[model samples]
Target chain A: MRSTLLIAWTVLIEAIRRREVYAIVVISTLLIGAVATTRFFELQGLGKFYREIALQIMTIATNLTVIIIASRQLPREFESRTIYPLLAKPVSRLSFMLGKLIGVMAAGTFCFLLFMLVFLAGCQYLKIFVSPPLFAQFLFLQILGLLVVATLSFMLSLMTNLDAAITLGSLFYLLSSIFLSALSYLYQFSDTAVKFILRVMVFSVPQMSLFDLSEKVVHQEVWPPVPAFVIGQLTAYSLAFSSLFFLVAFLLFRRRPL
Target chain B: MNNSSAPLIEVRNLVVEYASRGGAMRAVNDVSFTVLPGECIGFIGPNGAGKSTTMKVLLGFMFPKSGSVKLFNREPGATEARRRLGYLPEVTLYYPFMKAKELLFLYGGLQGMTRTQLKVRIPKLLEEVGLAGRGDTLLKNFSKGMQQRVGIAQAIIADPELLILDELSSGLDPVGRHDLRDVMLELKKAGRTIFFSSHELSEVETLCDRVIMINKGRVVLESPVAELMKPLNLFEIDFEQDGQPQTRSVSGAEKFNATLAEIISSGGRVIGTRTATRSLEDYFIEIIRGHEGSGR
Candidate 1:
């Protein structure tokens, strides 16, 4: 476990030190800064409008960062031949995978925290009345959502190349709401075989929308903070999907020749 | 339990293959050898001759198509086995974002060294590998030779019992190689096992206890360094006899001594005596040439 953390620390340090990650932070700050100062069409101060756009940007940017970071972990290791020296230590393949996943998650969380700060400053400028409990729940669900993305990216990275993994992972995260809706819409007109395939897709592909609390937070007048039972259900649901993806990734990686 | 008498690394009739476009390419074929504790063995071969392939199998980076490999009586790549070993890869590009000190700590920490231990040892290791006072520098700014030095620092950080170095002096300049040789000599004095492959045959001649020469995925010669050097030396007798300069070449020690005595008795003064020894590179090429088309 110590070895695992040590590996994760290296990844985290890289994520923190690499100039590109800071590029994301700078771009995100500018985007949020623009949104905060935007005139609300003809009106003066529409806090919800600014907050909604700000939150969406954070979600999209953070999720994309997570996918990009997670997907490249294995490919970069193999490409640079860095895996030889790393695995040369007492670390196991399983630990290596876990470390990468944890590191991606930690880096993603770091990215999100920076986004959150930017977002809060934007909210302060717009005088947006943020609900403490709803915001906390939103943060919790977003992290769980990020974990699912990280693990899925890990599995995809092993199954394909870096570009394809990032492309697929980002597409899945970006289009998840449409995907869930499309499945239900397609289920009506499909033949038996197509319906069977759709059913398999439903069972296999995680509903990224289920983890999204953005709508609830964006339209705060409609919903309050979620109950504990639902939060528990979301936690279990996310873990089940993450474990399935992680297990598939581990099966593929354990005996692989480095 | 690891028995002290057992071979540190053992391989039997090992074969390894890689998937090429046409089919499986056999990279190592029916190779077998053992490395005992406290021995510095040099694995020398040409490009594409399966030296790296065999090392990969021994390190558990790849699975062999057939036969067996064991390190410390445990299966290859066993975590327990790896903990007792250190490895320097053929291409040594480490985490470039990390400072040299942090990278050493990372490798050492993974192998179960405490931070206190690393903090104390990393400075000394950097100095030993000729990187003193450069511990805080990030690896990206380091030259290829400097990165190779960092690779060496990481490999020996935890001070494992066995060290496996591939292309030991790959990017080192003369001074860097000289420093590395000194460090390796010190390790040898401390009695650590080293198994390495190098295109640099002179390094092998200077450091190896035994040399294993391979060609076309097979080992052609494996012998103790002392015995191999015995027949390779050419003794020369230089003398002035009867107001004439003369030079005589002899093969065996007895003939050389006899020639020397005969020259001395014939009213002669010996000018100088020299022994021209055959280099390992010459011997390697000859053996490799002989082994061509000998593979079954």
Candidate 2:
């Protein structure tokens, strides 16, 4: 595990050295600064307007980072055939894929933290006493969301070209998390067979809504510890998604002509 | 276990196919060959004649549709098999963003080498491939020939027992080709088996001990350079006969002199007499054309 993390770190350093990660960092920083300057406003009883904006911005940034970075890993390898030399070594395909996943996740996580820091600093500059716990929950949700996006993108990259993979992966993430949230209401009123199918679909796509503590964070409400059920489900979903992606990558890459 | 005489690389009835847009195309068909230690065998063929396909199968880039390839007694994709073999593809594509030194280090590290090991070996390889002073340059900026040299360096970095090079001389000028030929010879002298494919028949004729010619996914000929180029005894006699000037062929021991005399005796006056001269290149072309014309 330690060695895998070290390889991840090596990948990160290489990414940063090439200015790819650095470019995203710069862009995320600019977005944070831009969002923090929006005029003061209010949104119903749900949350403070600025805090809501902050959460949304961080989520979008996390999504962009994953889409942009993870999608590039395998496609670039395919184009350059660099994977040949790498695979020719003692490393397994799983290790290479996992290393790529880690590299992308680390980059996303780093950007998430940076955006949070900038957002909080902006709040402080405006004399808004943003509680530490509020920021913490926002970051937790952002990281989890980014994890899903990274895993999905990594998987899609194995089967499709870079741009299409990113687009389809981002769509899958958005639809699975947001659009699929409506299935519960349908299950509550639908016929027995339809309800069972809806339930299965809900269970299959990640219940990202459960992990989104952003609403609670923005409201400055007392935050509950992430439920073990939700955490377990998310973990399983992430693994299943990543495994599916890797399996496809393995099947496709094994037969790749190079 | 002292089977020192066993072939360094053994392939039996290897078959490889690819699903093309038109349909499934057989790239290699019942192709079987072996490389003895210290032998530099050249695989020569026209474009798309299964040269690269066979090499890819040997390197584990593509799995064979049928048959078996055993390198060092291990399957092609097995880690143990790869560790003992080196490969250079026709196109040497590297991570454009990485400098030469970093690229080498990353690949070496992937092979489970320590930093110290890479540091010790990279410089010598760099110098050998004429990239000694340009280690810090991004691979993207290097010219095609320079990149090919670096590609060769990486393949031989581990001093592999078997080196599979696909079109090694591509993009190299005559001088560069000569220099690389010398390097290959040096490696062969060190007891390494160099299995390379090339369309340049002359280079194959000059460097290879035995040459395998493939046409349309089939091996047409596999013979030693000396034997492939052995002079054919058929004589061509041109003379002006009763009708119009015609050519006649003679057989047996008298074929040569009889043809010569026939031309002179017919008052045709042996205008010209030529014996079949077969070079390796001509033989390669002839066989390829022969097979291709037969619609094989």
Candidate 3:
């Protein structure tokens, strides 16, 4: 565990030093700043519009950053031959994979939180009321979604190059968000064979939409209180999906020739 | 810890294969050797000769297709075995963002060294590797030779019992190579086992107790340096030519004596006479060529 944390620490330091993280943060902040300073004071439902756009931007920035960084982790290490020295030590392959996952997740979470802070300050300045619990839940679910994305990115990275992995990760996220909701609508009219294929597809890809609560936070009139049972279900789903991808990545990495 | 009976590294009929477009290609084929404690063994081979592949198997970076390889009687990837071993790869690539001291501390920590131990040892190692007072410099600014020095420092940071280095003299000037040779000699004096692969046969001849030569993934010859350097049947006769001494090798003893007597009779002044011994380079070439000629 200590060795794992050491690797995690090293990776976090490396990620923090990268210019992309800072650039993403700066862009997110500027977007939020523009929204906060806009002349929407006399507009109806301005708070909802501001909340929706701000949360969407934050989500996109965080997810994009996470996917880019996670997909590049293993491929960069192998391409640069930096993995040689680390593996030459007494560290196990499993520990190394876990460390990378944890590090990327931690870095992603840090960036997400920073963006949230900026958004929240904007909300306060605009006199937009936000329930603290709902905001916290939004942050938690978004981070959980990012975790799923990160694990999938890592797994794809083990199988392909950095660019392909990143493209696949982006497509997965985009398709999951778009197609997951249509599964129920498509199920009613589909034949048995089509239904079976759709079922397989649904079961294979993570239901990332399940973790999205941005709409609820934006429109309080439509917001339903999330009970402990729903949170438990969401957490279990995220954990199961992340674990499956992480295990596949570990097996692939173990067999890799380094 | 002082037992001399057990070999520090042992391999038996090891084989490693990689998947190529032309089916599986063997990188190491039935190669076996041993390194006893405190013995400095030089692994000499031509390019694509499987030296690095064999070392990778021993270091757990690559697995063997068949047979066994062990360090300290434990599996190569076992923590106990890895704890006692240090490796410097042929191309040492480190994170360019890290400073020299930070890199050392990271490796030292992985070896389970305490903070206090690293605090003292990092500087001492930097100094020993000719990078004194430069520990705070980022690795990106370092030249290839300087990076090689840092590689050596990281390899020996934990004071490992067995040190495995690949091409240690690469990317170094004459003075740098001389300094490394001195450091390696010091490590040998401290009873550390060193097994390194190199194309530099002269360095091997000067530093190694024994040399193991491999060609085409097979062992060609393994002998003590002294035995390999023994004088052959040829003799060299040097005589004055254009105010300079020019030497020529005479194959047969009769021809050598006849040439010496002729030089004396002609008053050409025999500057020196000595038996000719094949250097490591010559023997390496001869063995490799012999294998090629045999259709291996």
lDDT digits (tens) for residues A88-192 of candidate 2: 665666677778778877877776766667777767765665566545655665576667677677767877789899788777766766668578667778999
DockQ winner: 1
All models: lDDT? 0.88, 0.74, 0.87
Instruction: Judge candidate 1 at residue A142 and give its lDDT.
Output: 95
RMSD of each: 2.8, 5.5, 2.5
Q: What's the count of clashing pairs in each model shown?
A: 0, 0, 0
- What TM-scores do the predictions have? 0.93, 0.84, 0.93
**What's model 2's lDDT at B136?**
91
Per-residue lDDT, model 1, residue A88, is: 81
Off by over 4 Å in 3: A40-44, A221-225, B1-4, B233-235, B241-266, B273-275, B293-296
All models, DockQ values?
A: 0.74, 0.34, 0.67
Worst lDDT run of 10 residues, candidate 3 chain A, spans A36-45
Q: Which pairs of residues collide in model 3?
A: none
Chain B alone, TM-score, model 2: 0.82
Per-residue accuracy of model 1 over A55-158 as CA lDDT, tens digit each: 88888889999999999999999998889988888888999899988888999999999888888877776677788888899999999999999999999999
Query: In model 3 chain B, where is the ten-residue run with the lowest total lDDT?
Result: B287-296
